[model samples]
Target: MGSQSEVMHCYEQIAPLTERMLVLARAKQWGELPRLEGQCSSMVERLKDIEPLSTLDEAQSARKYVLLGRISANSSEIVGMIMPQLSKLVGVMKSLDRQRSLHKAYGQPDDAYLP
Candidate 1:
């Protein structure tokens, strides 16, 4: 509530996280899965103003879309404050994806990553 500048800066930070989350969903590393899970309560809170999110996979791109919708709708209420947590979550998820993608790309059929 301090200023619009403050809010927009927060939005900037969250924007990249949304992209990173998209990749995480694609990678499906799923190591720090708690970060995605914990947001359910926050999403529940936003439901009063934001549209109800679909029953999409919680740790996937659809979930990220729901978050972007909420963030766009309630930019003022949420942006500045959620950064640290979301950044940390996305950071770890990215790290996990880097390794997970490699393990997957080079994986043998018996490695359990194959269909």
Candidate 2:
């Protein structure tokens, strides 16, 4: 087991947050995401400010790589969960635009439009 090195600590703090983000994403718990994302972003900034993990020993480097991989996997999963909803939202917006264009082009009754 590696000691509490700065690089290791940073990864430790981030990995669980990534896991939690994945969980929240899966649950569609959007209201909680912004706060958690902010915390993760802050940790990422701190990690970026610190020296790279290349200075760590072999074990620590391996651990860092694993943590980064998990974070990447979790993020990818989160994107997968979000993409479908985003696509649906875009489709609805396009449909609304089409309706607005039709309303403008024709002298149809305003009530004819679907809300």
Candidate 3:
């Protein structure tokens, strides 16, 4: 937003991080996601703070459009990959809750339910 180049540079920096996130997601390296996601979020917050002083020229606009499209696509795919795992986790949590409730109803000791 400071200049056409500065805005474009920010976009340029974000594009690779999104690509890396998509690669990690595809590889099912779930543990690395939060760290990469934090980095991407920080970049996006920086973009939001930028005040547009000038408009992008045709080529820069095109590149920005492409980078945005890639970022969106990669994010969508990552969500798709994560949803099923999240669902399974929710199921496990619900099951644990149910077991806890049943044990309480029966007046069982705290350690009665051993996994």
Best by TM-score: 3
Residue pairs whose backbone atoms clash in candidate 1: none
Clashes of each: 0, 0, 0
Local accuracy of candidate 2 as per-residue lDDT tens digits, 54-111: 3787898899899999999998998899899889999999988888788878877656
Provide the TM-score for each candidate, comma-separated. 0.30, 0.72, 0.85
lDDT of each: 0.50, 0.83, 0.85
Pick by lDDT: which candidate is best? 3
Model 3: runs farther than 4 Å from truth?
A: 1-3, 51-54
Q: Is candidate 1 or candidate 3 better by TM-score?
A: 3
Candidate 1: misplaced stretches above 4 Å?
Answer: 36-115
Give candidate 3's whole-model lDDT.
0.85
lDDT (10s digit) by residue, model 1, range 1-115: 3333333334344554444444454455445434743453444444433333233244544555665775565443344435655798999999867767887778733345434
Model 2: per-residue Cα lDDT at residue 113 = 57
